[model samples]
Target chain A: MSVELIILIVVITALIFDFTNGFHDAANAMATCVATGAFKPKMAVLLAAIMNLIGAFLSTNVAKTISGGIVDDQLITPQTVFAALVGAILWNLLTWLFGLPSSSSHAIFGALIGAVLVQAGLIGIHFSTVASKILLPALVAPVVAGVASYLGTKIAYKGKHNLPKESKKRYRNAQRVSSLLVALSHGTSDGQKTMGIITLVLVAGTLQLGGDQMPWWGQAPGTGPHWWVILSAGIAIALGTYSGGWRIMRTMGKGMAEIEPPQGFAAETAGMSCILASSHLGFGLSTTHIVSGAIMGTGLARTPEEVRWNTAKRMLIAWGLTLPAAALVGGLAAWVAHFGSWGFLVVLAVLVIGSVTIKIVSSKNHVSHENVNDSHEVTVLAKAAISSVTETIPNPLAPALPEEIADHPLAASPLRLTGLKPRPKPKVPKKKKTPPKSKKKKQRKAAQQKAAVAKAQEHEAAREKAAKAKAAKEKAAATRAAKAAKAKEVNDA
Target chain B: MPSLIYAIDWMALLLVAAVSIAATVIIAALMSVSNYFFHPPKGEEKASQPRRILGFIFLGLMACVVAFGLYLMIPYFH
Candidate 1:
């Protein structure tokens, strides 16, 4: 394919990846708020969407970091970037489907590294930069956020406690404000990643076109993303946030732990702080990791029993596997796309087929706004296990009762309740119809109605004026009477 | 081990950790404190004037922190 065509494809794929990034991390901003009933699920996502859009425009430091900081852009091609995005996008979809909150940033980083390694080997990869800027920050950010959140949660509950009703009301309101801040910071940080990737593609494409210099908006060669690139990425992420990732939201909000309002407030505030700081420093750390860690920390602080260690273990496994898994897929994609036009077509076809298959399978157990907060399979399994153990202990008195053997309460009832009692239908009030009037008659009736309204206004104003006059006269008479009484009392004395 | 440690930007990493932890804690604490002060026990009357003023101060501090964060995002700062 022509270079121009390839650049176009890469840009579109980058936007697609940005969309997935927004929806995938929507849970990070909204999960706790939704779980704690601070905001309705739909409203929370809408607020997040608007905030993400505004946040995208706040700064481009992170974008510059991504485009130039991690990899040697001179050696990599736009096609390589495209392959990396495919890997990242597919992984994002896979994790979202499983209700796993893995890092989209890590997936993209892994894919880029793998693709670059396949194309130009170790020379194209910046190990030191990756180690310092990306990897180290990733390891530390979550712990920092977690510890901070733990302390915050501890302090929040330290005071002489208010009534449950009052405290809950206060915490819920506080959660609303804190969650908005998280969503705004998320927009500023996560939305910039796609902008960086798109800028990388543009830089590569410009170089291929024999342009030795970067665009004026960029600080230096490959230093900044173009304005249009920022706008497109911001819009894509905002749209994705608006769409809502109910499945992952359910996982983070309700699946990980039972989040109270105060804990939710603490977690979101801490997560927002870490993310905003990282973005300012241009570190592309995962907001998912930070927020999830904070949630877990707050859960531990509030009540250790509330945190689901098993679910957390599952999430950690997913996080551990994301890098290598995405790397392998990215390498394969790069190898396939190396063959030119036909290979590109094949890769595209595979991506479409794989995405369709995942969508079709996910439809079997769809998670949407209506059921985003419903207890998921893990909780259901636990409940079932508890009930089964309870059922096994046979009651000695009811050992021979066949009805008692039934699991359902209604089934065990001796009086058969066939169905719910039907209610009486409400009587509809009928409208009376009048005979059709001629045009002149209608006009006269309208005029008469206006006259009647004017007359009523006049009468009302007159009545109000009379009432005010009467009240003033009564007040004067009362004051005079009081003065006369005082004078008479003085004379009598 | 020294060489390996030297190869990494240990200073920057430490700075990041310290800054992140401090900022997160400050923000969370301010928010939680604001919540506590704003909502007193049910039997009691609503927040007194001074307590209300204190709550607003805490909330204002939190907003300042967020604003400062956004200010840091400007490319010129970096």
Candidate 2:
């Protein structure tokens, strides 16, 4: 392809990746509300779409980071970035198809870093910028979310005890307004990141601009994402939001916890607050982390039992790995592209094929809205498991639950669920006929049988223990009553 | 040097035209009422002042983006 043709193709490819990014992350904004039936899917997306467009008007902070902060544009043109974007886009599509909530932000970052590393060697890598901005936020956001949700749930349910009926109604109404504000805030903040990237591409194309030199940004703040750039980014994202990433919605909305309307509101509000604050300061905070954290926080607040630690562990692992992985990929792409056009083509093909393979592998379990609110899976360790299982005894005569069952949570199984943990994966020794899986399966079966026997044994033991405790408690009460009666008789006499 | 800026005038004009056309097309399509006779709503969802304020915010945003883009594209003070 001619240089002009190659550059044009690359630009289109970048926009395509941006579009995919839009769809990939839509659930970060609307999943909770949609999951809770705050709005119909269509309405939720429409609301998100319009607000995102409006949000594009708010700030240009994230855009600046994309266009200027990550890689030197002078060293690479729109074409090189285009190759990086292609890598990101492929990763996004594959992840979306399989319902993995892998970060698009990370994918783009990785692709850019990998390409840059390959091109300019280690010199191109801006480890500090990536760390301070992307890395810190990605790791911290979710932990913050988990803590916040834990606290928020604890407070809302506990605090409501003293309130009158009218006051509770008022709180519910307040949630509605707060939820909308969060949606608007998300649109403003995240929509800007894409804008900054597009602006970088445009500025890099011209001879007027030097390699990696940002004289304009030095002169002014919010000068990076040009006006048209904002419009395109907003429109693209809005359209993507309208299309929706349904698979991701299932993962974000239902996979994390049993999201009640109030909790959903709380999570979204927390996410919006974090996102808006970062956007204003020109920080390219990951909306994914913010939203994920918010959900985890709300989970903590309501019922720490329902927070799926196993699933969360995998997500955490992905979070930890995404930056270095993406950086490597981007660096590699940069290296290949440094050989000129042929290298770009080769990198692009590898990305497409590899992502497709990953998609095929990871899509064994597909999360959907139909099963989102169903009973907690064993794979997920939601605090709500106790409530769900205790309710499922089938016999009304089993036992009376304590008043604070949601608070004091107990697991029905002997396995002792501690909420979302990463499933222990066995490593392959590169030998033929691995028997570990079946061994693991047989082990699981034995464990299940043992659990059943243990349950029976524990049940009888528990009954005997409870019977004795009850007798003692009743006897003490009876003695107190008898003493009171005797004292009354003596006084009357 | 002067000719370089002048030569880019056409490219700049074309770029601006493409952008303006997109914006105008979007506005015209959304604001048009010609089809209302065929498919009238029981109640049209009206955008209130606050909503309009929000809409204007985007417009103001569009203006800022275009201004900044022009600033970048323009070659001055050689």
Candidate 3:
């Protein structure tokens, strides 16, 4: 492929990566708000999208260092960037499929390192930058944000066991405001990364074409990405945000903590503050890590048990794996794509196939705006339904009963209890096309049905007998009272 | 380990922690105080006009804080 064509492909790939980044991190800003019912799932994502778009337009400072100083700028090639994006995009899809909130930025850094390692060996990588920037911040950001959230939550619940209705509404309003800020901050920080990548590719392509001077648009690197670059990146991220990663939202919002309005307000404010402050201080922290930490802190503030440690552990594992996993993928893609245009095409094919497979697999147990609030595990309502159904109608036909649900009865027939249509008595089937296992199961079911019928008849007989005896005793009492009255009247005469 | 520590800007980390904590605590406290004024104990009579106004004042302060946050996010102002 021509240099311009390759550059164009890389630009498109970077935009695709930016889109994935948008959806993957949407949970960070809006999860708590959605969990607390401050915003409906659809409305929450929509508001977050708008805020991210606005936030993207608000700043360009972060776009200067494309890899955040992780890889050697001198060695980065358009082809390597393409491989890196493929790795990042695939990793993001993989994490999103499992509903884990992994860091999209770290994925990019890892991919860049991996691709560069293959392209130029160890010399192209900066080990110290990785250690100091990505690793340290990943470890520290969460803890700091968590502590702030904990203290804020404590203050929120101070001097009150149960907040009044009016107070909850007030907290809800505050939570909404905090959540919007988080979204805006997310947009500002993440929206520019794509712009930087695009700009980097453009500059590299122009130089490779033997241009002695910089393009009019790219004359000053510090001036940031071209106006169109910013616009396109902003739109791409916003659209991705609007798409809504309901799976990850469910995991973060409900899986981690049972967030109330007060806790939501606290966690969001804590996260937003940390993000804004850290970014301003020139050492950008992972927004995902900070928000996740804040959420856990709020959970702890309520009670230790309120925080789902198992879910937290799972998330921690995902965060730890994000870098290495993306790096591995990036390395493999780079190795394959190093062969030339055909090799790049092959890598692209694999990425597409992998993404489609993940998307298909995720659809099996769908989580959408309608069911986003439902916990991954069987929800309380579903559990209640199971109990009521099992208690009154513990028949074999009640679809696939678990072993834990035991039979219960309250003077009611299973038919009335379950509201299931009564099956016709199994007439001995003649010449039916039946599988052998199903036929045997059917025979067993028939036997059980006969026994249940017999039990019902016995119960009916006993009830009738008791009712007759009660009628006879009442008759005898009335006759005795009448005779006593007659005897008293005769004695008076 | 020492080099990693040296590489990190400790002042920035400290600033982040302090700013985040201070902002969180202040915002949460303001919201709580406003809620308290608007909704006192169950047995108490309805809050007087001045108390309600005080509650609004707290909420207004919260709005101001939010505005400051907006300003911080926008690099144009910075």
Candidate 4:
């Protein structure tokens, strides 16, 4: 396919990845609010969505960092970026399916690194920039947020001792505000990653078309993402946030830690502060890591026992594996996509099929707004399979078959499908007949009564209006008389 | 150990940690202080004049800090 067509496909893929990032990390902004019941799941998601969109307009520093910092733009093509996005999106979907709060930022970084490695070899990847800008910040930002949250939680509790009931109410209100900040900060940081990717694509496309000289539309090689890029990224994330990632929200809000109102406030505040600072510094820090660490820190401060160590460990494992796992997928995708148009077609087909399959599997035990806080383990493929099997089996000791099942055609088949019995329809209750003349009389009476009530209401409104007008006129006359008397007294004096 | 340490940008890392930690702690402290002063214990009279004044001061400071941070996030500001 043509480079323009390929660029279009890459941009669309980048937006898809942005959408996944929004929904996946939504829990970072909203989990505590949902957990503390400060806001309903739907309301929390909506608030985060709005804040994220606003946040996207706040800064392009992080986007500039991603577009021009991590990988050498000169070496990689739009196709390479497309392959990286595929890796990141698939990783995000996989992590979401398992309800693990892995970093979408890391996934994107890893995918880009891997794809670039495959395309232009080791020199195309910038080790120093990656180490300083991405890796170091990822490691330290979370720790700082965690410690701050832990101490913050302790301080919050100390304050709570003075005002138990009132503090709880205050904390809940404060938590809502803090979560909003976190959502906005998330928009500033995470939303820009997609903007950066899209900008890089445009930059790379323009560079390819015009040899060494910079194109007119491109302007200053790497100042920041364009306005349209930022807008699209913002909208994609907002739409994703509105969708609500209940599965991961459940994991973060309740699974890793049993959060209270005060802890939620502290955690969200710390996460928001860290994210804002990092974004301003142009560090593409993971909002997931910062929020997760804060949640764990709060859990430890409140009651170490309350923190689910196993769940925490599992999440840590996911975090550790995210880079390499996404890298592997990205590398493989890059290799496949290197084979021209036919390869792109094959990869697209696989992506569609894979996404549909994951969707189907997720639907078997869906987590949605209604039951997000039920605190049950998500239905895994194995568990779903077992449940399906159990549902099919009939108790052998049962007295007799139901009449409906016995009479069904499939029941007589050699397969003896126990669970395939046709459902029996409910019998409608017979209606009692009424005399037509009485019904007509009642209807007319009801209409006449309605008209009388309307007329009475209008009469009452007119009377009230007249009373208000009379009071106004009386007050105006009294004021006028008082003013004349005052003027006459002044003249006499 | 020195070589490994040299490989990383210690100054940048320290700055990130210090700023993040300080910001987080300050915000949390502000929240704690607000809770203590604004929401007094049950059966007690609402916050006294002095305490209420202090509480408002803390809240105003916190709001300013957050607003500044957000202001810095805008592309134009950078």
Candidate 5:
């Protein structure tokens, strides 16, 4: 195929990746809210989709990073980027197919790296930029998210406990605002990464700015892949969001946390803070990392047992491998593509054929809207079913068991939660090994324990921390009150 | 100086990095999964250290691979 046709094919493939990203990661923004019944599936995605569109206009820094920050677009060709994209897309598809929560950011980065190596060797790598922009955030962003969520959850609990029923209603009701902000923030942050890459392709191919001048369109393209590119990428991601990566959603929404509205709201708010900060700074921090870590952190804060360590570990592995894997495949593809236009055609044909086969096969094995919102227990069972179908689902302990996820029930192209094995169901009961004591005794003991702990800490710092903790307590108490009132009102009538 | 030795070593480093990156990810995933069956009753202390180490290894290997990959890809310009 000609270079023009080659670019077209590559962009389409990128869209395919984006589409997978949409359904695969939709849960990142909407899963908690969806799990909590804050919004119906349709309403949740619709809201997420619209905000994602609006978020496109947020900033162009991430776009710049992709197009210019990661690699020197000038040293390579549009074809090189195309090769990198294919590697990225393939990695995305493979991860999604396996249901591994791999990172698109990493995949793209990897593929770009790979393609650059094959096409032009390694003349234009920026170590400082890579470290400052990518590595630092990769490590810290998630941890920060987790910390913020843990704190957020503590506050949520105290608020639930102490706030008068009337005022606590305000925060619960304001979830709409926070949830939508997350979608908008997610869009603003994620949309720009694609823009940056495409623009990088344009600048590297068109302008001969000897590595010194980073030529950004700074404006939408009037003719080529311009504003339409921005609009399309946003819409693509939004549509992905709308499609709802429900499998990952279940893992995040229910598996990680028994999120009340307060915790969910706080997690979203904290996630928004991270995304907005990163977008403004123009770094390509993984939205997946920030949101999931925050949710897990909040869950951990709620109760240490609440955060599912197994699933979280699986995600960390995916994030770690995504960029390098993409880069590797990208490099391989570039090497393969070196065989003239025929090389590109063969690769393109393979991708088109392979993607179509997956779609057809996946359609047959879908989780469906009816079962999508089934309780977390049912979702785990659904995953268990997929694993049994594909004996490839390894004992998560086996070094390679990460790839056993045959179907991701939550997100689209974003695959994760791969380690599935025979549950030590018997052992699960062993953790609470105590024989069932009287319910009243357990409740009283729990309260007394909480009170005793509260009393022991009288220092001012502890007091302020307790003060923050008190808000979540009140919120939790209010929710309990609402549950009680609803029950009582039924009895009175 | 950006010596010839610097150039060739980076390429070799990339291959080592790739192998390590793949192994580290697979190893980390397995160990965590092993949590359920082998040591089904791990405390926070048990889980946290292995997890941190695994994560640290993954990041370390990835960074090394990227650094070296960039190193090799750099000399193709002139």
Candidate 6:
């Protein structure tokens, strides 16, 4: 009964891990497409979700192995698997909080290795598989994809000056297609991992207790995941993809490199092809690593300076730490669960508490689809500065600026936002002059005065013309009167 | 060292790399050629009818390759 309870926990945790896997890798497919404006942010995620749903039902071959036989499943119980999942989920959330695209597959593998170490000691792990399968592919796959994308981007830009609007539009359309393939490839690879884990847990539980008696839910070690498992895993992952990992999307799309439509098309094509080929060859390469490398390669092909090496370095560090960090946490979880059922409850408590804390911290620095396309580091820093400023210094002049500008994320300084402030009055003899205005106001006043002066001059000119005409008319009338008087006197004589 | 070497299938890895790079390069080249003829640079004569048809043919080929990639993903196809 205790073992069954553990198995239930393991299955639930596996599904949760699958959910994280979906969102964590959502950027791998849609980031380039969204960055290039081929699809709107919400629309891109929706398309990726639909493709992921279709791809999950495509195959169950990858579900056959958990860690490719790295951890000896017979030695470890479902409790160990539960601990491993806890570690992987925490790591996934941690990396997501930092907006780093690390591998969910590697995280699980690392956690399994850690849990195995705690349960069955060093003898339970296959070190060679770890090196060749995990480490080797991690190193090599990215390089291959990078080189391919570099070449592809070059080909895309050939005869490039003033690329026609029609051609650019076509490239965006091509980017959408290639991005869909990537999303499908991600679904086929990642969605199957949780199914694999859940199946392993069921098999391990049934075989350990029942021995030769085959249970309804449990199949042989080499058998496919059950239909219910497939449906649940597919739905969980599709829902997660629809949730849209905006933080990681922003990091991949705008942080590492700025992607143009043609470059995005090339990167998605190259990355998708690499992932498909590797998966076909039974190599478990990370979609995140391959796509990130392809984007960097494409950026370098066009303008090397645009690639943010700092962010890339940070991502590389996170990738390096993913396995070991997950291992540490998983090992700790296994250690706690080894104490008893109480320890298991304690582990569950830690997982929930840790997840909640990370969520709270992430909410404090929220990155939604609206601000996802903004330059990441600058926007984050600016937002941080503004929030701090707003807390510390109450901007007395905030009302003076436009309401929208004052409340903008990038508007850190009120002075900078409005660029208008009352100028300090210059000291002049009190009787000599009125108060000095701001430079802008002075310029406006000068313009107004110039218009007034021009109006006054026109008025004076019109008055002089009227007065001259009146004087000329009066002289004519007098002359007529004198002429009449002279004529009358001549007539009387 | 020997164990590590045995654990990896180097030939398969190299094959995957080669195939992916080749496919990407070919697709990119085909798309470029299609664009070059279909939507030529401004201040130049429009591509002739035969050239436009040739561009369409290249585009059709690219579409076929993408479809082939999709076909590879389907497990039943294997």
TM-score of only chain B in every candidate structure: 0.81, 0.40, 0.87, 0.78, 0.36, 0.85
Give the per-residue lDDT of model 4 (tens digit) for A382-432. 433222221344445545669977666434333244354343335799998
Worst 10 residues of 1 chain A by lDDT: A381-390
Query: Can you tell me which runs of candidate 1 are displaced by over 4 Å?
Result: A61-68, A159-163, A211-227, A281-284, A376-493, B1-4, B39-43, B73-78
Task: Compare the candidates by TM-score and give the number of the best one.
Answer: 6
Q: For candidate 3, lDDT tens digit of each residue in A1-493?
A: 7887788788888888988999999999999888889999999999999999998888876555578678888888888899999999999998898888999999988888899999899998878789878998899889999999999999999945456677788889889989999999889888988888888788777777766666554334445577888898999999999989888898889888787899899999999889888887876789999999999999899866877898889889988998899999999999999999999889889988998898887776667787787664322212222222323444555454454543323223356345655444357858877679989999999999999999999999999999999989989888999998999999998
Model 6 residue A126 CA deviation in Å: 1.8
Estimate TM-scores for all models: 0.75, 0.58, 0.79, 0.76, 0.61, 0.83
Off-target runs (Cα >4 Å) in candidate 4 are: A61-68, A159-163, A210-226, A281-284, A382-493, B1-4, B41-45
Residue-by-residue lDDT tens digits, candidate 6, A1-493: 3777877787888888888888999999999988989999999999999999888999777555576778775666788888999999999999998899999889988998999998888999999989988899889877988999999998998835335678789899999999999999888877887788888888888877676767677667777789999999988899889888888998999988887889999899999889888878877678888999999999888888878999999999999999999999999999998989899999999999999998888877777777678555523323442322333444665556577666644444544535644233356766755466687698898999999999999999999999999999999999999999999999999
Q: How far is A375's C-alpha from truth in model 3 (Å)?
A: 1.1
Model 5 misplaced stretches (Cα beyond 4 Å): A57-67, A159-171, A199-225, A281-284, A360-365, A375-493, B1-78
Query: lDDT tens string, model 2, A284-325?
Result: 457787678778777766666877887677667767766666
All candidates in order of lDDT, best leading: 6, 3, 4, 1, 5, 2
In candidate 6, position A331 carries an lDDT of 96
Better of 1 and 3 by TM-score: 3
Q: What's the CA RMSD for each of the models?
A: 19.6, 23.2, 14.8, 22.1, 24.9, 9.2
Candidate 5 chain A minimal-lDDT segment of 10 residues:
A407-416
lDDT of 4 by residue, B22-63 (tens): 887787788778767886555877778888888889888888
Clashes of each: 0, 42, 0, 1, 55, 0
Please give the interface root mean square deviation for model 4, in Å: 2.5
- Highest lDDT, which number? 6
Q: Please give the range of 10 consecutive residues that has the lowest summed lDDT in model 4 chain A.
A: A382-391
Off by over 4 Å in 6: A159-162, A211-216, A378-493, B41-48
Share of reference contacts found in each model: 0.55, 0.00, 0.80, 0.62, 0.00, 0.82
- In candidate 2, stretches whose alpha carbon ends up further than 4 angstroms from where it belongs are A58-74, A159-173, A208-228, A281-284, A346-493, B1-78
